[model samples]
Target chain A: MNTTQTPCRELQVLSCRPGTEPTLVDLVLSPPGWTCRAGQFVMIRPLDWGSELVWPRPFSVCDVSDAGLRIFFQVVGRGTRKLAGLQPGQKVAVWGPLGRWFRIDENRPNLILAGGVGIAPFVMLARREKTDNLSMLFGHRLDLCHYPYAEIADRIESEAMRQTTAADIAAFETVLSGRIKTLSGIGQVLACGPEPMLKVVRRYCLMHGTEGQISLENRMACGVGACLGCVGRTVTGEYVQSCVHGPVFDVRDIDLGE
Target chain B: MDQTVQLGPLTLKNPVITASGTFGYGLEFMRYGDLTALGAICLKGISLAPREGNPTPRIAETPCGMLNAIGLQNVGVKKFLAEKLPYIPPGTTLIANLYAQTPEDFGELAAIFAAQERVAALEVNISCPNVREGGVQFGQDPAMAARVTSAVKKRAGSKPVMVKLSPNVTDVTVIARAAVDAGADMLSLINTLSGMSVDIRTRRSRLANIVGGLSGPAVKPVALRMVHQVTRAVQVPVIGMGGITSAEDVLEFILVGAHAVQVGTFNFMRPDNAFRLVEEVRTLAESLGISSWDEYRGTLRA
Candidate 1:
């Protein structure tokens, strides 16, 4: 569903789940307004409430279905507090199926990297009925809150997984041994989560000659280019709005970390 | 509907005006909507000299809001006169939002603006810290607010002067009274609140600057209450703004004592939001049998 089809005024809350008390919320919107690629987001505003949050808050679309849209967010201030407490049957005002999406090639095996709630959008893609040959390597502080993904068959690291250099990879390979398949035939890699994990994914992809795209998070005002607020400097030195230019970019085009 | 509003000596064709810092020179949003329909345009905050502003990561997103410390980046008054002032639309209120490090800087800029009849009013923005005056002087104290107001009014000569107050103060009403006593003709209340966002894993500040001013819906209630308080304290009209995105929001401002309201952060979300807001207010007023939007001003109960 392209976002243009959904009018800004109409949105329905389909389901609600609690995350990180009084702070984080996982909500799915009803009657899916639009189709969004893995890295895109939508703007949601609480309707009819005269409280000060008149501008919409941009949230990554954790999952989407024919029934509605789903979002995972942490309640930080007034806006999210209002959003988090909303009842399931209630309505919320929403705008856009916005921003560019991460590209995927069906011909290659997919490698998904997620950290914390950054796993939301990728989980939405992995839940698809037709998706195949997908593997997710997720890093989280603990195992309790790891996202529920039924399709992600292999986990590269879990409670026992630690940051490994080349020597550790050799010793770790002993566990998989002959079962470990080379990343060959993997045309593109998709990763989102924390900047550090993404930094590591970019390096690993390059060392293995695997192509990759990563989703970035930033402080955004207008989920569009109008505000010039949520901007990131590309490798080219030009400032581009993360909301418009992308929450997703080719790993090669970004300067993640020195 | 005929779009125009009267702000003291100036008559604006529409009640929709761009808030400072969001629209740059009023030229940026012109590409998206008809600038002439606006009641007025307040250019980005201008200081005596050009400022490069704060370092990188000037902005960061929160749950339902964003923080910014652009630090009033803009060319000086001379460049504004040379490049920006010429394009002011006839009948549109062209307000120059002046920020300075000293009362003298404001006086000088006001005198420069006074020379140009096209400039409608001098909006003294005392929110920026007065670097030379020892400490955070202008905004925190009522005396400094009045001092800046008096300085600008004196240089403004015959032109009406409006003072835009900072929200960082303890009591906005005290500051409002001081500006009125100092000869200000109008007031714009409640700039962004100071805020910060930190990356959980990195445990570093989300913004390049350690802290920034919070804007958008998060600060609306705080802004509205300040507008109400300031309007009650001062005899001059108040222009209330912060998180105003709809016509109902405008009505809320008017009911709370705002003579007019400015749309700030919403301009970034939807370029056409202001134009739509103006039309919506007019239609709602007519539907309710009110001849003018002003009829509902300051109707808030207690």
Candidate 2:
């Protein structure tokens, strides 16, 4: 994309997050000049957001179709809270299709494990290529109805659970373990969610030696690697800026320890 | 609007240089705008060896600004000149911001840049903790600040040395004068203020380092006061910064006697902000009936 020409402009969103727990913001922007991929993201701020909210919030690009550029996220801070209140035709300052992307090997069995809104980037992944090898297992505290769970339902073999308790979480982990065992050594595991959830998935991937990629969500200021704010530690004991290197990192490259 | 401004040995195409650390290697913002368009690009601080820097959660958002303790992480000077320097376009004027553990190391780093003709000037960040003196900040002490300044000046050759002053002191002008008296060609103030924040629920400091440097719009008033003080204290050219958000802020620095202004934290708000500000500064200068920077600079009434 000629990103220089594509400065942050006021794009009209067809809609904001449809439910309270999970959001799907669709900005009325097309991606002709965009080379947007599944794991890449953007830093967005609604125009009306006062100076009180200093920095733009980063989100994984869900899907950028003719309908608009979509991002899935839940309100976690002042920035997201203000983003949640955005309505149709409201102008938003969107600067992205940024960071590294997930290069899905369409031929391999892909077991997608998502926690809460961590399932966001996978929607675009599911949309781009539909194959018999792909499936998603989503676990959230909020019910599946509160999420855009049904959007990719028909495209892949999907399973979701609402886990609010220890027992519920343990039961979900059993299901997660079973899925990794089922995928065996052949499948590539792509997981996203809170860090603890990623830690669990990372363990499963390691135990079964399943090759995959995991997208990270860190507190970020600049998405362009300049601010050096959002760095994730590598197993090699180096800090790489997730904003530039990979919000989407290889399962082997990162060290997400407990 | 004449865009050119001279600071000792170097002449900038414009007066809107991107602050060090904020602008990266200038390679990161290639898509945002042309690099040569700005007055100059000050790269992140470079040390003798690659610094691993601080732990994660290095930044936190404050009222109109933010706090960051990046630990001055950067590639060593050799790699910067060998790998990073060649990639930056030839026409673009580059300023190398140098940091070190001791005065001797500071001189060595200075000579590294001084030998490179591509590096137009040197910005010495005296705000760093001196390891030899048990980690006291060089900028916090006038004698220590002068020692570092003289070390850099002795090795910097004909390259203009701009000592960046810290605001976390009793009086910034004291250090500013010490630097000028020790042969600093130009001065830039104020570096981020020392501050901290906390998360009530977690009972943890917002930044991992506990204390971080605060920048952005929140520190403008304090920055202005310090710049005005330092300009009156020393004869060298003054480059002012702090919470500079718009063309008005750029001119405010000039009005307060800054020869030029460096746009820092505001660059994080928008990647193209510094590029866009060049024209905004010219137009704003014209609208205010300011002809040349020479006539308009330091014209603030008491």
Candidate 3:
């Protein structure tokens, strides 16, 4: 576990862009001290928000640069709704680059599967890895524009998106399994999505004996491990705190019972 | 302003202490600020053996608070003492919060910390609402609360025993009196209030445990009333906590008769919040012409 973090700092919002899709947003804040690995995330909340929403929302760091700390997210609920209303120069409290990072198995062909807003972190992953061997399989219920495809578009070798209808899902699975079948014995599966989608990905990886890692979006009050509010069970029956042990876990390490 | 406050026989440099279960062994927040600056740091609840806690979806955010049914997932006492305890910085006061299924188990758990020189005090958690066994059961019954207090007090041996009281009870003062009568050196009042949240879409409970203890600013008023009741009902020094986010909240607890205050849910909003409050309280108090905890504690006119 990476205990290193940029302690909470009130950074001014540099820019807030409504995504191509209405609910989606690209929020950038100014902070030079923070850096993040592909899979790591930050806990953030608008400083003005008091008990209106006490707990800060956790978002995967989409990209970080001299420009600002970028986080692409969907305004799913009250927190994001409030976040969407932000204007430039408004400050939000943030602490991050917390949790473990993704370990790219350099030897293996990595297949990344992202669902809807789940594509946020992979933008950083795809940008950093720069591996021609990587491919992205994106699935979402909405149109292709709803997902932040452009941020990650030029980074990977190939990309595909499928609507979440049953037939479309089955087709997506066929294409994913076919790609894994082509790898023979040397492939890695990395995914972040709705639970049901990740469950399918985990099953595919487990069945094919390919190494897999899935980033879990567990609800956490405190981003630090103190709250114990974001625990997930492992294959061995041990409840691991997602905040500390991982927001990302190996498919075999966690048990998604049938 | 004088920041020091006496919590029973244990003297503290300041009134702000991070509550148990929220502070995570006291080492997790090292990135935020100095641990030695706070009065003390109470750790996660420890039992005789390791606990797996509840199932998934253990937390849900509410309007002003959150519901958590962590069920006390913790590394066991032996493991906590072995791996977790040694790493905490020296000069930082460490309070071992104990949780058990029975009075006998409570006494044995207390004895483990009582003999360790690193442990500064024992905070007995007789009130945890999420677990299926032990904690809340012992808390709801005065006899059981008294038994647990006496059992821990017998083995505590000069180390202060602060029995943390639950807010789920009909009359919190009844349990407060029972624990104080049984030999609690101090009392920390108002653990989370038991509550539930539902997802109307699925027609299912938000938390996997269905019900969980509620904490955050939402419970502040309830905590205030109970702390006032308990502080007046018992002679022991009282440490008050529940949804405390700022130095103002810390003073609110003190003004209502708390010897000291603990920062709980606010630690979630900002990792360095409790540390910030340690300084914020000084600034706030100095501006208000308050020089010491003695001048303000329990001075609530109502």
Candidate 4:
């Protein structure tokens, strides 16, 4: 397929879970474009009609292999609601390894904080991708509230076994204190999930002088830059759209209030 | 195929624009698509002073749609001209989408943006949710929509003032007629439907904000219906949008009386969808031997 000319391809739905429904679909792309980095996402469409659905729902690239990509998304709205209804082997459309990736510095001990499905990308980043000393702090509504943490644990275990070093990737499930203040430890933290959680994590990072990058979950249309729907204010007071400039950003740089 | 369209004094090479709130200042999406190729790019919604906007979970997805509660986050009028104006594409029509809590605020900001020579047109964004005015606000009410339209038009003077309407209204045509009566040069319909999603398992609102404006393909039929109705009710040209992903969709809107079409969420679906829409409209026109796509604009049958 032509790199720039060909439309981004949709792959078969390997699975679709209707509860907290995370619809996982694979997308096969050509050339260098297929490698969706950590904290990156792809725009997915459930059907073929061009503009039937007003917006393209963005899904976190939960996992990807050389064969294709995976998106972990909840069936929250009209788009996802339709997606959640799809059975396995059904076609799901997708576009791009869109937006910038989670910036990782292997030099520092990595601290991972995931809120619900926001943990999707971190799973990809943590597995096989070596970190100096990886410690993960995951917060959900409750222990079995939502998201695919068991799958994350499996990847971490498998990756650790391959490395021949059982450096425990510490995991936790703490109740939402209405604020993301419970997390601690590690020099650099990567957090994703709901807005409130990311905000608290960001504030904690700023106060403690710890470096952090947060994966922003904003409604996007193109998953590209055509629509300026996902603008996020920066700490520097500049408006940067979350879709183009990032799905991930330095936690301190984002203005979470608006 | 020629993409340019004459909007008042401005001549655009294309009819597809980055609708307000969808494309921030033109400088934001320079890397994603051909910035020069667009007919116009409306910056994020601007107000008299900086607005804090709404709270988070600002966005939530629906079937073929998503809801947004951004609340028009922007650097007020003065800052926009000083910081963002210089960065827009030179020849492209630069429309500043204006929002205000009151009619006076609209007039003040319109006057300010009109003063800047760089701004080609003023897109009065009356569709914003008014936090202060006891919620019986402009844009939702036809009379208030007209009031704000007249205020902006009077301040804008000779500059074309396009009023963007909200789909949350009961009768969009009534509001459209009010805007036209208030001297609007054009009207853009269907700026997100107010909707919400819930996490049934948790029994909570899906978005941090209780409600958000919905946009995407799911809203297309509703948008098209509004465009059709508004075009019949008012004389001003209507710019139709909602879930525009292809050139054929552009033709469909034009046939339904949309003078132009704005590609919103489609931009997120494919970075190049805007350019593709422009190219497809041209190819579609040529294929039909229409000579000009404008001839087909607003030619829809009742």
Candidate 5:
């Protein structure tokens, strides 16, 4: 894959809004040549901060437009906290359009399972495809936290769980099984969110005999596959760097063991 | 300015090389910057057989540095020679960083790399802290270090062997002397300091392996001291590294008698750092009125 290293540039922030939660920052960066596909991500670092945080943080490409690329993130750690404080004209070192993107088969019906910020990538996937054969299942704590997905999704189903528990997952799985039966053709399941949600998605795909792809979220030091920090286990018992081999992997290939 | 440096029979275009374990096979960084601008690329550590490495949470961030227990995860020698070697851009000097559990394993790996036409040199890794055995264990003991060095040198054929020294030792010079005595053509110091981190909330170790090798700017002072000590003790050319971030850092190592310098953690910070350092070193050399690196190599006034 041909990846470009975009230097630190002042991205004119279109807007920073509180999406569904107080911690969530929906930021839009209008940097030129910032084209990205769904599931691809960028490494972002604060400019002028010396040695305090040496590594760049990786965030999935939420949405892209002629205006700019949108990154929806929850301020969880020091890096994200610093990013949340950035003003409209401030610059950040952004390097990417990296990693393999979500492979969508136009012929197969698409089922997207997203939780929290994981909803970021699916928005782009839905907007790009503009297909009627898409079904989205979003799990969130509060109704406000749900991404405004009415415009992009063809058939949207959501479950509000304060915290996704075993019971909630079982219910979600039952709903997914029913959804799979109603679809006419062989469908593909794509998932991104918390690891637990992905585990559920993986199991659902296995039981229903549906092909699945998952975007893994691992703590990464270098988003460009140098550090080997973000590694996921493969079914073949080998470890592959999530930054390069994938942020996206076949659900069958990944060994997500407890 | 004259930028080329000689390590045994290998001649590098400049004194800026990418450190092992930091630069993945040299192809990943090509899109980010001009990789050919580098003097050489020291690939990730390669063992006799494929290693799965450590479990999850193999990395932890600390003040001005990071700790990693990657455990020398690589695609083994055979796959590396087949899949990785062909992809390297022509004219780029490639150094194979080899690791093994025993002296015989080291000899076998050396022979494998020695047969390869593309490899410019073999960097015998005697100092990887992440692995449970044969990594820092052989590196810390002078006798064992000498054995590993001799084993590689015997089968290395005409290929030059550079022993990468570990900083986790009582006296780094002892190990340096041992490798040099065993026919090591050049030396690279230091690998990474043994360190660990813990999570306060969970009350658990940060890395799965409990302890990992620490790299980045935090270890620069220690690395510089070791590089200075070892270079003065050994007759062979030295390749200095440890938390080198800028051109000034590269020059400091050169001033301490390093023929060349390797940039490690900084690659994570900026993928084009090695390319940038080539220009920075030239600019600095011109400003200082030093036409050649030889004039200032080890000319440190202490």
Candidate 6:
């Protein structure tokens, strides 16, 4: 439990890209010593804002490097709309390398599933894990939400885009079931997306007797455990904070049912 | 410059205390800044038994503030004493925020802390809006608020008792007067205002608990107004908090007669907020040519 309050630093934007969507922005921030696990997130706020935008927004760690770390986000609200407008060399206050990350087992095969901006966390996971042992399935309602990852595409088995439809879901299930059956050893499923998508993934893991972990996206004020805002129910009917206990949790442990 | 301020019998090194529930036992923040720099560390709300708290989506962000229904999820008082108390930096003032389903529960918790030397005071939380039980119920009524205050004071022994008052009432001063009359040594106001948010896309409530306490800069004016009114109504020292984030906000509360101010939701935005606030207060005080806070305390003109 390395739950230290992440120091606030002014991260200089190295580059900015008009990601897969017009509203989505890809930012490269160079803040020295900014390190995070595959499923971890950072709390970011614009320095130029007034009290109107007081709370910071949480974003999953998209990618990392010695030069800096990358974050991908959509301009869904006022806070992010302001973030998307930031240019290269601009600085934003960032506090992170926070929250629990995915538990990677190198020996086992990995099946990664992501939806829309949920693809953010897996970018780091893909970079860390051995590509040969990894398989990815990405779903999107529109092509604009698809992220272009040239680096890890050659090493890993990946499906860049599967339309989010009833027909595509069945096809995805068949493809996923076949992949699971063909793996030489025990494999795990890791997913992040909307609740409906996560529910489908949960059912697949339950039916196949495979272990899975899902990263949840709850609206949060403090990325730390102090606020008790991002709580989710465990299978045992007890509530655990999604920020501290997890942004990532074992599928078996999370009780998604209402 | 004199930074120390007296709150009843207790003398705080500074006037910046970390509001309860946001600081989380104070040890978790050691890496961000110096914990001892704060006037006091008001530990998260504690009860006689461990609480699991509300269901998922317990928090939601509003226009300028956020709604949280944490339900005072904390380990029991005994566990807090055993696991958390020893970790608090030596010589740091620890104000235990006590909550319960009834006045008797508050009495039991107060008695437990009354025996601990390190426990400086008890911020009896009869104003929490998240819990469905005795929190806001006791805070809303002046008589019940007095009863809870007296119950904790009776068992608190030598330790001072500060009654935390809620702003979700018709006249907060009436409740403040009641707590003061019931032997409350000091008062802290105003707890989060009751609020809720909804998701238009799903046509469902954003928080699983449906409603929660709203805290942040959004509630500052309301909190300041309540603190101002209560200070004029009661003789006990006042610790004001509602959306205090800056040095100016702290000064505004002091100008309205708050002996000290609590930093709450701002801690989430900046972990070292208390330290920064302490320095800001010092610099501001020095610039104003004031030797002590007493010169400016309650200096707000009509």
User: What TM-scores do the predictions have?
Assistant: 0.64, 0.96, 0.96, 0.73, 0.93, 0.94
lDDT for predicted candidate 2 compared with the true structure:
0.84
Model 5 C-alpha lDDT per residue in residues B122-222, reported as the tens digit of each score: 99999999888899999999999999999999999999999999999999999999999999999999998999999899999999899999999999999
RMSD of every candidate to native, in Å, equals: 7.3, 2.0, 2.1, 6.6, 2.8, 2.5
In the range B41-137, model 4's lDDT, one tens digit per residue, is: 8778887788666655566656676677766666777787788788776776788888887888889988888788878888888776524441226
Model 1 agreement with the true structure over B1-302: per-residue lDDT tens digits: 44355678867675667788777677655545567777778878887788655656777655445678766667788888888777755655688888888888889989988888888887888764322241236877888888888999999977889888878888888888888999999998777787788878999997667888777777789999999888888778889988776777777888898888888877765556676777898887677666665666788776
Clashing pairs in 6: A242-A246
Across A1-258, the per-residue lDDT of candidate 2 in tens digits comes to 443475555577676654544443333343434548888998887767655666888888878876678777777777776777777777777787788887777788888888888877887778778578888899988877766678877688898888999999999998887787777677788888889888887788778877878999999988888988899999999999999898999988899866
Q: RMSD to the native, candidate 3? A: 2.1
Ranking by lDDT: 3, 2, 6, 5, 1, 4
Output the TM-score of candidate 3: 0.96
User: What lDDT tens digits, residue by residue, belong to model 1 across residues A184-251?
Assistant: 34456677876766776666666566677888886666665555566666777656668768888887
Worst 10 residues of 5 chain A by lDDT: A1-10
Off by over 4 Å in 3: A1-6
Q: What is the C-alpha interface RMSD of model 2? A: 1.3
Q: Is candidate 3 or candidate 4 better by DockQ?
A: 3
Model 3 whole-model lDDT (C-alpha atoms)? 0.87
Error of 3 at B300 (Å): 2.0
The regions of model 2 sitting more than 4 angstroms off are A1-9, A17-35, B128-136
DockQ sort, best first:
3, 2, 6, 5, 4, 1
- TM-score head-to-head 2 vs 6, winner: 2
- By summed lDDT, which 10 consecutive residues of candidate 3 chain A come out lowest? A1-10
lDDT (C-alpha) at residue A172 in model 1: 35
lDDT of 6 by residue, A117-165 (tens): 7878887777777657677777766673346444446557877656657
Q: Name the candidate that leads on DockQ.
A: 3
Candidate 6 lDDT (Cα, 0 to 1):
0.84
